[model samples]
Target: MEPASHGLRESATFDRATIHAIQRAAETGIYDIRGWGAKRRLPHFDDLLLLGASMSRYPLEGYRERCDTDVVLGTRHAKHPLRLSTPVTIAGMSFGALSAQAKEALGRGASEAGTSTTTGDGGMTPEERGHSKHLVYQYLPSRYGMNPDDLRAADAIEVVLGQGAKPGGGGMLLGQKITERVAGMRTLPVGIDQRSACRHPDWTGPDDLAIKILELREITDWEKPIYVKVGATRTYYDVKLAVHAGADVVVVDGMQGGTAATQDVFIEHVGIPTLAALPQAVRALQELGVHREVQLIVSGGIRGGADMAKALALGADAVAIGTAALIALGDNHPKYDAEYRRLGSAAGYFDDYQDGRDPAGISTQDEELAARLDPVDAGRRLANFLRVMTMEAQTLARACGKAHLLHLEPEDLVALTIESAAMARVPLAGTNWIPGAGL
Candidate 1:
């Protein structure tokens, strides 16, 4: 069955020729196994930060002076608009992968911060729904826990096309974290690893996706905003399509985005980075005249005030956080170095959320491990982080001579690195690359 490997090999840019040999070795049980992006370190948002105003710039009062973070997400094309009191929101992480307490904590934190929380591949949980003032029901391809009642109760509905960690990939839930409760939610056989299909069951392209949006809107009787969430890969085209499909809001998630559990290969090898994605999403919105009409929420490795400010400057109306929130809830602290090392990962670098062995206790289904986390405290930390992000974003906005966070412009940015500059399409500090210098 392996006859044609001799001729076409010359012209092939990439070939599956090595896979045959590799699979055989893997079949004999692995040794020093590593996955994509597993061995290589990529530039994260934390690698660079923003510099605030100086003599030529004015600062905004953190405690007072009206820094409005309010955003109306669905007004552009929705009968019942989705409103947020702040620009920072929570990205979806499944309840099973993250203990119920963690999901509740996220809800509590977002509520305290005056924003929204999203459901993951699994359906809505009463605890999360009750705590989150604004709950977005996710309609992922898996259709797990999906019910009409949940959809009816949602403040909005998000049709998930792709996520940042694995843009064109599927969702994964490791067997260890698949508790009975989780199993029931996903309707899968107990103790088996589950993978969600990447493609939607009903649609293929954006045009079909638009119809799906319309159908959902009609199903809800136009009472809720319809949103489209796509990974950062093709934000420009996807955002434009989401708007054309009558989406009231488009959320762009970047590669650095978090997941409960995925193969290291999927996490690192796939998707565009958030820094590169925000601008593309904004451009799409602007071209469609829905830049602010419909809203844009960006996520991926967003950790602090600097990231939030940078995202807003790049033209996002709002932002979402995942890993950072977990950190706020006490993930990867040095105290857990011993436990992390036991799992073959360092304390500050663990990403195996599906193992049911999170040292921080925020991402485990094991009762004892889950109990180690205090939701009340974690929620408070998340709120504080959100406040700081707001403060920083406001400060940057004022320094740029803008009165509101939404007014922060690309003109205020100078690339910290060449790759960032090229990908973001911005100029170096002293370059003519920025045609609109100070708009």
Candidate 2:
């Protein structure tokens, strides 16, 4: 029914989606829970434009000149830092949240692209370790599958303070998705819903975190990099505190960061945008006199090379991707549209990752559905996508007269909107004004 045909106007405050939410709440008496990142529109990388070289600056020839994309992370305190050919990396996605095959595919793709992949919440899997050249083991509060041996085997360790999608909340794995293998890995009952602890049980403050870092360094003989990851809220202080706690690298995840399952309210209401948090994190690092010494990796809504280049220009050493990587592995392919519809969603609109019924096999724990994904083929597709992103970033860097991706500065960028100019700390297009620059 079209409102226009009935000559009726819809309320701006109570839209159709809002009305549906009210109806759902009344029917189920439960708050909505779903997967993916923040769906709300916010200031993002698209609001920033790169200024190509014309008069004062010189642009490099596309085929004749070189623009390096190599990046070295965790050079501050680690004996062996991660030296990658490109700055893009795969973000953490737990073994329980994703199938073993999907984890292996991520490892293969990242390895082929000369980058790193992380072991998310439920701990390291043998398949991922075997396929990945450089793997960062995530140390979450849950301590799901954590072991000293896995810690020693990891190339790097990331201590997760919080996730962007649920800043003050824990992770959720419904009973439907909690298969025997997933339950065993997480040390929980096979058909029971699990919720992780929001904070580390042993540590409460920076001092304890410092001790934890020391323990991790001792466990690994100080050979591996120690990273501290925090959600976008209080990013400046979080970065400062993480560095003070002896972190070798810091990763800031914005509100747009994806999750396997979380409350709808938490996903849309908590944390700031990636564009707004990057500058704050950079300022914190600069103030500590370790701007480049302690690397910064930002994640949230990074989609392509343009977003990656923009993040680098804003002072991030690298960018991590989660949702985009899954898409690359064919999570929402058009061929699965019919199956998606049967599941009450379309290919592009599917976000029910916790249901354990994924048609593409990238997010399910079901045996038959999981087998539908060919890890080898999916890995090749992911590799191709990563290569294209790297090339796109290089193209943008050349146009901006940057000899390397790390050379891209905020000066080469201009904001298309006042909000973006204020958030990105760049000048507005065709003007020298930066909103709230002095404030």
Candidate 3:
């Protein structure tokens, strides 16, 4: 037998996946659309490390010390603000994108964990509202299922200007995921592709947004807090604008944030990373002298307690999770490995949430697939995850000699890479140099 011949290596710049994508696009004459966040890695929390106390700083005794994780959001101009027991909250994942059971599970889990859950593009669901103790209703460009009654029912309202997955682009719910119920909620034809408007139809700029906020406040009788959620791109300006628009809280979602469905190009190419966006958003708030008063919630690529702690250290009042929350609810459980494989993907690798064939039942619309998930069990799992995350964050806070998670500051952190140092605005490990500090 002839020995196997080695061919020339593929170009690192244009790898096999890139070549395949190009070929696919050429053949189909269409852009590749898929679910989830950026596939390419960027600077993230893993690149930063906590500088635990030893000689210079005092460390608290783990067993005897108390490390509070509570956070109050939307205090700037709200008559009633949301006081959460944990600094970690659930980010928005729309009803049309997530199964109703999944929505219920998210609400139950968030409520059980003493945090808050948010509505997404298709607006609020009764299942979610009924289960969530503190629910934040989203006002998106699509405005599907939006009503004054539901708005009044919410504990808070988040006016979503953009999402991290596709910053400038609108939302996409493929035809396959659009069931009759979803169609009814969105007031669209069943099995038809739905593209949410990129911008709000009624409002144009920040001034217009201020008026809308006032209108919402009036409609709700000034009872609910108003939050402005923006995709992280020009975050410094966007956050400033949101605050100026009378938002009680500002949520900045970075590129690593997930979506149920969007063009793959947008997810990979658009928006800034969470580590890069957080400091800018904080700076904007500080510039306006509303850093804490107009609370900031940072999202995107927040995986565990460490990420939450890092966000808090960087001056975010709280952190929000979407992909991580779904994972906690069993979106890609190893138990469903066989089913995932059958769908041309494997557990931990499935990203076809747009197709609505999720084996874990969290992202599907089919009755049998959706029925696979028990909301109670999923909620319990999510609650456990949240508890673990909170505990982990508290552990780090105590190590940094902080009595509360909010007391954690940038001084408690150091970056392992120049990119991370620049993005997180932290000093490099083994050096006092913070890239771009003097600039």
Candidate 4:
């Protein structure tokens, strides 16, 4: 009390976390690297509120009216485009970064929820494929575990150029998590650190990307949809280019997206937020006259039904979730609080997925740790979460007077902050002023 009265205050530029970071760096020459998405606050979906139908508008009855959530992706090309019952799909999280049981659980849950799950960086696993009704195989720059048979076996293919957490940067998998099985799947030496390439080896630009898309189509006999996934940087130009590159679906991942391992600096400063990126992608798609036709699947920091509804209102065909999915799978259960404490992290704060010491067994490859998670139970939990999220979205959509989830539009939203108003291109709350309109 005496110190406060005397005007003793901490500097905003050098806060407690900043001071600790500086000290940590001084002690160790190497920079700190950890798992998870950006920790810093940014303008996000939470800043936007849905406008419920009132005097001038009419909202649907929650109990009697129907709000359709079904979405058809990859309709632009492919013999069989996916028809999902819900617009919320599971995002890519690689086998190497997650246990086999975890991957299987994700597959089972997504299938049960009538949505698609993706095979991330390290290729397809039988556990995932056997359970998932619809799976998208990721064609990553690393080419880890890539196979023609797996490609053909998948329901669709995603050509990943970058992810949101570390745009223009490579991925990192610590040596500790790279066991014999992980090494075999990725064709890497056992117990050696793995680093993914930032760019594809064969392609340099969109022109080359077109050629690659053609090759992928030929490989699958054009039966599967080809998706081009990119981080949310230069999104407008990127979306336009992806369409021209013959992509049937475009996936934009924002900076808030999770990762297994990457530099802290990269996670915080590399990319734009999801709120800013979605509008740009939609604008680009609209300008090209393929907004709904091409299908835009957005990812990064998407959490609840409100976030889903907000994304839909801003013009996304669907939204994908990764971190929330893992959480639903019990990645940070309070039952493991003691174990988390031992790891110098709390149950809700554990994000060092690269350490291979997860108590919940969702992120580790260790035999004993991985055994702790029952795939069936975890799958059920995830399914429940997915169902709840869908219901929430439906509730919001109904309030917005939307007959279907896709019927949500920008006019139904208002931003809480000027930053959010600018980022989302929505009017500020209590006013009709958009922060950057006509600029």
User: Per the 3 Å backbone cut-off, how many clashing residue pairs does candidate 4 have?
Assistant: 0
Candidate 2 clash total?
0
Per-residue lDDT of model 3, residues 33-129, tens digit only: 7787998989999999999999999999897989998888877777789999999999999988999999999999999999999999898888999
Per-residue C-alpha lDDT of model 4 across residues 341-410, encoded as one tens digit per residue: 9998998899999899999998899989999999999999989998999999999999989899999999
> What's the number of clashes in each of the models?
0, 0, 0, 0
Q: Which pairs clash in the backbone of model 4?
A: none
Q: By descending TM-score, how would the candidates be arranged?
A: 2, 4, 3, 1
**Residue lDDT tens for model 2, 1-439:** 8877999988989988899999999999999888899998999999999999999999998977999999999898899999999999999999878888999999999999999999998889999999999999999999999999999999999999998888988888889888888888889999899989899989988999999999999988999999999999999999999999999999999999999999899999999999999999999999999999999999999999999999999999999999999999998899999999999999898999988899999888998999998889999989999999999999999999999999999999999999999999999999999999888
Model 3 off-target regions past 4 Å?
1-8
Model 4: how large is the Cα RMSD against the reference? 1.3
TM-score for all models, in order of appearance: 0.87, 0.99, 0.97, 0.98
On a 0 to 100 scale, what is the lDDT of residue 240 in model 2? Answer: 95
Indicate the residue-level lDDT of 21 in model 2.
96
Q: List the pairs of residues colliding in candidate 1.
A: none
lDDT of 2 at 222: 92
Clashing residue pairs found in predicted model 2: none
Full-model lDDT, candidate 2: 0.94
lDDT of candidates 1 onward, in order:
0.79, 0.94, 0.93, 0.94
lDDT of 1 at 201: 92
Candidate 1 worst ten-residue window by lDDT: 31-40
lDDT of 1: 0.79
